[model samples]
Target: MIQKNKYLIGVIALLALALFTVPCLAMEGPDSIELDSLAELYEPVQFDHIMHVEAAGDDCSVCHHHTTGTPVQDENCIGCHANSGEADEVACSACHPANRFQADYLNKIDENYRLNHVDKVGLKAAYHIKCMGCHEENDAPTGCQDCHTRTEAGDKMFRSGKYAPKGGNKSRKSGH
Candidate 1:
């Protein structure tokens, strides 16, 4: 009976550890917070968190930008979005009304983007202006080969995934 009880306790502990670790290792499911862009649904591209964490030396602060000189809390992309220097920045919900368009977040543009003829911005331009701009300045890969493969000579990196869902779904309709 003593041996049986010890075995049962060990099994319970193993089960609990498995339940938690499986989700962290799995590429799919909400439990994993990989590739969390508002554009995710529009793209459905699963970011390899394990891969990035390994390559980037486990620095959670690498992707997070905060004015407080501290890392952002987990699962909070908007903290950085709201950190943009633009004076007239709007909420992600304003453009991504129905919570749809899944490249990860609503593809927000600066008001001056339209003034500069960037209103009908596509994924590539938006990503370049917003994400890649910083990555490039930091000596990161501004080219497709850095984050993705180039199937063609002129293929854009923003559209470099296995699939590129066209914009027009009701869930992803533009707020502007």
Candidate 2:
């Protein structure tokens, strides 16, 4: 009986450890998430999700922009954003009442974007703030050209090498 109990206890401990560690190690962010949320501003920033994950050393929540325990994977983003359970999974513009065709759309010449953008934090603001903020925080490039280089030559260069931070040859500090 004693030996059997010891084996059971050991198995339980291993199972518990595996349950916790697997999610941390296996939280696979998509390789390249297109941040077309703000395409009107720039030519839809194709964010290097994998690069960001490696740079932040596996802190997936930063770009995910969610709390560690937030109820997620229940549905895609549009479900909550459009405020409907039956809402169709579609382009953001499908439900959002914003005028994308306006000339000022790209420029964000509207004063709300210029002054109070952070308050409501629209799709454009969310992407920009998260991406640009992380870049600025990490001393990464904030220049639009640095990220949005999707030209013929640029695509070749981008795919050729894995992106590391300016001084981050090694991965960021690991936590588990």
Candidate 3:
């Protein structure tokens, strides 16, 4: 009876984890997002999700690879993708600093921080490397306005695009 109870509990635990994590992972991230991280350098840029995925031949792994992470360490997609600056104890920038990697950036690390990428790069560097590198490889538009545009209309225009995820609805029944 005890063995049966343990097995049942284990099943329940697995079910709970699946239910919890699945919801978090459902979206293909936001579409037409105006970046707020480095608004000072240039006008806020809008990101088009559907266009990029289509350009990449429908392979989600190109960007979502952050979820699986590099060989050295495993990180949840939410950890780096969102990287909300509003909250205390943020994880992204301490390791991936906004400016270049230096002793100053390393000094900011929390005691429990885990170093994942073999090459140390900052949050700014990560965005530029991934987005620009892909564009350069594909010979796609790399113009300043081509990727992102100024959020001149104000916050109202940020998520105005509302790009739908695969399957057409939140159920994600259509499948990617």
Candidate 4:
């Protein structure tokens, strides 16, 4: 009887330790992440995830919405997701579609009448909205160049850098 009791206590202690330690280990995300989903135009953003985590005071919900099991902080979201627990996947792209406006994706959204997030933003817009909003509030760099450097394709599209039209604004007379 004494041996059985000791073994039971040992199992219970191990279970308790695992319950506390596993979540903490899972919460420690990568120190940095290369955000390259929109790399077609801009260079991949080297996001300092650890810094942002610290800045957010370890609250994953600041950027992760209600996916991290944290109570929703946004007044707009709290109504629907106050108790919506942790999601199976926490990646942004898992929920926000990369090609949000694609016909198939739009059709799916339209077909799913029960989907609560009918107006969900695309992946690119999600990053910009969340990052820019927080940066603005924290007085961090909010300029495009601060986070994204345009690629050659982007420069050409904007007609900037070397792609800019030559000649220093010399007015040309139109021949009638």
Which candidate has the highest lDDT of all?
Answer: 4
Q: lDDT ranking from best to worst?
A: 4, 3, 2, 1
For all candidates, the clash counts are: 13, 0, 1, 0
Clash tally for model 2? 0
lDDT tens readout by residue for model 2, 1-176: 99999999999999986676454432433577676654543467776666666786564444442333222343444354333322232223343324444566545545556542223344555556767887898898898678775444444455433432356466767786
All candidates: TM-score? 0.26, 0.42, 0.45, 0.78
Question: Per-residue CA lDDT of candidate 3, range 73-117, in tens?
Answer: 225544664432222322334445676556665565544267544
Cα RMSD for candidate 4?
8.2
Tens digit of per-residue lDDT, candidate 4, span 54-119: 798767888888998877688989988998888888888899899999999889988996877989
Task: Report the alpha-carbon TM-score of model 4 versus the true structure.
Answer: 0.78
Which residue pairs come into collision in candidate 2? none
Instruction: lDDT for model 3, please.
Output: 0.55
TM-score of 2: 0.42
Preferred candidate (TM-score higher): 2 or 4: 4
RMSD of each: 14.7, 14.2, 17.3, 8.2
Off by over 4 Å in 4: 1-26, 170-176
User: Which lDDT value does model 3 have at 143?
Assistant: 77
Local lDDT at 2 for model 1: 100
Better-scoring candidate (TM-score), 2 or 3: 3
lDDT of 2: 0.53
Candidate 3 lDDT for residue 141: 78
Q: What's model 1's TM-score?
A: 0.26
